[model samples]
Target: MHNESIRYLIVPGWQGSADDHWQTHWQKSLPNSVRVEQADWLKPRREDWVGELQRVIAADSSPVILIAHSLGCVTVAHWAQLAPLDTLRQVRGALLVAPADVERANCPPALRNFAPVPEHLLPFPSQVVSSDNDSAVSALRAMEMARNWGAEIGILSGAGHINVKSGHQRWEQGFAYLYRLQGRIEQSARRRA
Candidate 1:
C-alpha cells in the first residue's frame, strides 16, 4: 500500500506524549494518523494496553504502521505476542523507539508489570530505535531487543530517551527513520505477492 493510504497508529508511553513531544508532533503533522487511546495511561495494565491496541487495529480497515515509544513499544510486543497471525498481518511494520526497561530494578511501579520482555521475532517487519545514553534502556539491552525481535536497530549519539525531556522535540531524524520503514513493508508485501 502507498504511504498515504496506510494508517499511522500512535502509541505513546506512560502518561502519553506531551504536547511538545515528538510523537505528538508527528500525530498532529502526519496524515492518516491516529493515537490509540488507553483507558488509563497513568496506571497501565498490560492487558488493558494490549487490548486497546488490538481494538484500534481491528476497528480500522486500512493497513497500519505502528509508531510506538517507550512503554508503548512494550505494549506492541505484548499485543503482537497474543494477536492471531491474520490480525498481525494488518500491521505492515513498526517503529519501536526507546523501549522502556520494565525488567530493570529501578523501573516505575506502574511500568513493572510489563516485564519479561517478549523475546520472539515479530511476524511483521520492525525497527528498534534507541539512544546511546537513554536512562530507561542501555545500548547492550537495546541491541538484544533488536536481535530478539528480528528487527533492525539504530542508536543515536547521546540522545537521552528520545523524548521531550531529551531535547528530541520535533525530531526530524526519527521521523525520517519511520518514513523509511514504509519501504521495508512495501518490499515485504511485494515479496509475498
Candidate 2:
C-alpha cells in the first residue's frame, strides 16, 4: 500500500514531544498525519487523553495507524480497552515506542493515574519498540508489555527513549516499522477480501 493511502495518528507522551522530536518531524513530513492533541500536556489526565484520542479516531473515516510514544502508548492501551467496536476497527495498527513504566517506583505524580498498565491484548496489529538504555522503561519490562499486548517487539541497542535528545530525529528505522505494519495491514485486508 502507498504511504499516503493510510492515515497516521501521532500520539506524543507526557510533556509532549519537543519541536525537534521525531514525532513532530513525522507529523510535519508525512501527508495525512495529525497528532492527537491533549488538552494538557504537562499534567495529563488519563481519561482526558484517552477521550481526545477517541474523538480523533471517531472523526476520521480513513483507517488509522497510531504512532505513540511513552504515556501515549498507555493511552492507546486504555483506549483500545474502552473504545466501541466500531471505533477500534478504524485503527489498522499501532507503533508503540518507549512506553513509560508507570508502575515503577519513581513514576511521575501526574502519571500515577495510568498505573498498572492495561494488560488486555490490543484488538489490532501493533509493534513495541524499546531502547535498551531508555530510562523511562526497562527493556525487559518493555518486552513483557509487548507480550501482554500481543505486539511484535523491537529492541534498539543503547537508544535512550528513542527521542530527539537521543538523536532519533527523522528516524528512518521507525518509519520502516510503520511501512512494515502497513504491509501487514494490507495483506490482512486482502485475505479478508
Identify the leading candidate in terms of lDDT. 2
Which sections of candidate 1 miss by over 4 Å?
1-3
lDDT of 2 by residue, 1-193 (tens): 4756678899999999888899999999888998998889999999999999999999978888999999999999999999999989989999999999999888889999988899899999899999999989999999999999999999999999899889998887788888787787888788999
Superposed by TM-score, candidate 2 places the C-alpha of residue 48 at a distance from the truth, in angstroms, of: 0.2
Predicted structure 1, TM vs. truth: 0.96
Per-residue lDDT of 6 in model 1: 86
CA lDDT, candidate 1, residue 173: 86
Question: What lDDT does the true structure give each of the candidates?
Answer: 0.91, 0.91
- Per-candidate Cα RMSD to the true structure, in Å, reads 1.1, 1.1
Global lDDT for candidate 1?
0.91
TM-score for all models, in order of appearance: 0.96, 0.96
Residues 1-193 of candidate 1: C-alpha lDDT, one tens digit per residue:
4557788999999999989999999998888999999989899999999999999999977788999999999999989999976679889899999999899878999999999899989888999999899999998999999899999999999999999998989998887788678778878778889
Worst 10 residues of 1 by lDDT: 1-10
Query: Deviation in angstroms for 9 in model 2?
Result: 0.4
